[model samples]
Target: DQQVKQNSPSLSVQEGRISILNCDYTNSMFDYFLWYKKYPAEGPTFLISISSIKDKNEDGRFTVFLNKSAKHLSLHIVPSQPGDSAVYFCAARPGSQGNLIFGKGTKLSVKP
Candidate 1:
């Protein structure tokens, strides 16, 4: 069974707008949440991440928020640009030493 799930298959946002991507997980043991962005054939690039100890984390234009009670997490991109268009994968780690479990990914299309 898939532990992580990205309900939306795709998302489209206009340039300069805020883009929100959501993810949910079934495992309560997960201690870390990570977001990765992939551009076509290239590998997925690490975006932002949040530890279970914290509710939010921010890095430049990217932000990640975790709601442990709900077993949900979301990634926010402010002033999204066309260059930000990519497939976003949501991943979670069960513990410090555990491998990450990834969602199917949601393709984001930022239109100019």
Candidate 2:
């Protein structure tokens, strides 16, 4: 069974608008959350991350929020640009382990 899930396979948003991507986890052992953005013909790159102890973490136009009780997390991109279009992967690290479980990923298209 997949521990991390991104129910929406894709999302579309207009330029200068906000893009929200949702992720859900089935394991309570997850202690950290990470978001990765992947462009075509390229590897996934780390975007923003949040610890389980905190509810939110922000970096420039990117922000990640975690709800421990609900085992859910979301990534918000403000004023999205066409360059932001890519596949976003939600990953969770269990406890202090180095391994991370990744979701199927949600393809985000920021239209101009």
RMSD of 2: 0.6
Per-residue lDDT value at 107 in model 2: 99
The CA lDDT of each predicted structure is 0.97, 0.96
Predicted candidate 2 versus true structure: per-residue lDDT over 20-65, tens digit per residue: 9999999999999999999999999999999998999999999998
Model number with the top TM-score: 1
lDDT of 1 by residue, 63-104 (tens): 999999999999999989999999999999999999999999
Off by over 4 Å in 2: none
Clashes of each: 0, 0
Per-model TM-score, in order, reads 0.98, 0.98
Could you tell me which 10 consecutive residues in candidate 1 have the lowest summed lDDT?
Answer: 44-53
* Candidate 1: residue 35 lDDT (0-100): 100
lDDT score, candidate 2, position 60: 97
